[model samples]
Target: MKINLAALQIASVLALGGCTVLPPQPAPAPRGGTATPAPKPQLPAPPPRPAPPQPQAPRADAANWRDLPQTPGSWTYSAESSGSAVRFGQPGAGPLLAIRCDRTRPAIIVQRAGFGTGTVPATITTSSTLRRLTATPTASAAQNAAVAFEITFAVRDPLLDAIAFSRGRFMLEMGGAQTLVLPVWSEVGRVIEDCR
Candidate 1:
């Protein structure tokens, strides 16, 4: 009546192997309704990112109140013949620029010492104004007081007044020549008044 233990264990294992196991299933939906899905576990949200930087306007420089692009150099201004003519230059050098009054013609003649061929445009810049005028080569070096070019303006030209009353200084740009930044002085106003 005694049974083999090994054989009995093997028979029980073979019997259980034939059966299948599965996870629990969800219930069917009711008539005319959809089945809802199972809920999922929730997770915490991540930290927020920083905002981008905004553009800012430029700040004013107190040290350079004038806001000049280039610093001007020291110059000397002299009026000759009671403002009939004015010259601007270094104290010890010949005149770099001159403005003369032609009383007979009632015109103002501006002259610069530079070498250029033919006629060219001269650009004048002041704090609040800019003007471009035609400059013709002087007919004779000796006749123009050794100047190479000249710009003639009517006695009542507004540019004359602008140069006289310019802020601190005015700039003169000639083609193929060095630019000159001349200081505004009493001589400039005097010449304008005399010409007018």
Candidate 2:
């Protein structure tokens, strides 16, 4: 009744010699044994912090249209930065450039106009600055005095921020990680050419 093979190879070599895969031995510095201070280089826990670079779309300035301006004012301005929404208007005579991109983020605007029999009104033009700032997207022809405009700004889901501040444009928060483009019209964006 004691053939030993039934002992399952001596109980599997005494349970594999008391189970030892060896990798957890840090408890022998007591009983007045003093020297146990060399285990603090565990920085592999910092690779989980790579999600802060999702803040793109702010590195652009290749527009110098001779630095923009030569009178086109009677202005109105409003500001909101990051979450985007702004309003501005300029009209002192012959033509005008009024903007209100009410924020679902679809924007670009430039102005300084009158084309056919021009005199002194035409220095810049860019469009789609909406907030109902429309004149029939050009009621007759794409007349201009000077121009440079772009579009793709949208408001219905503009990456979504509560329907883009409810189409009234709000959310340009400033401070920390730093982001602000409320140029409200930077000194009239050189006199109305690029509405950055």
Local accuracy of candidate 2 as per-residue lDDT tens digits, 3-116: 767798888988999986879877777796797798898766555555566754432122432133333334454454522223333444433333334333334333222233
Q: Candidate 2 local accuracy as lDDT?
A: 0.34
Error of 2 at 29 (Å): 99
Candidate 1 Cα outliers beyond 4 Å, as residue runs: 1-83, 140-147
Q: lDDT per residue, candidate 1, 1-196, as tens digits?
A: 1468888888999899877687788898878988888888888898898898786422121223235443243434444554478776656776778888878777889888665556877888777677777788886444324446888999888888888888887777776456776778887778778867
Those runs of model 2 whose alpha carbons end farther than 4 Å from true positions after fitting are 1-69, 72-74, 78-95, 111-137, 141-196
RMSD of 2: 17.6
lDDT of 2 at 7: 90
Give the top-scoring candidate (lDDT): 1
RMSD of each: 18.1, 17.6
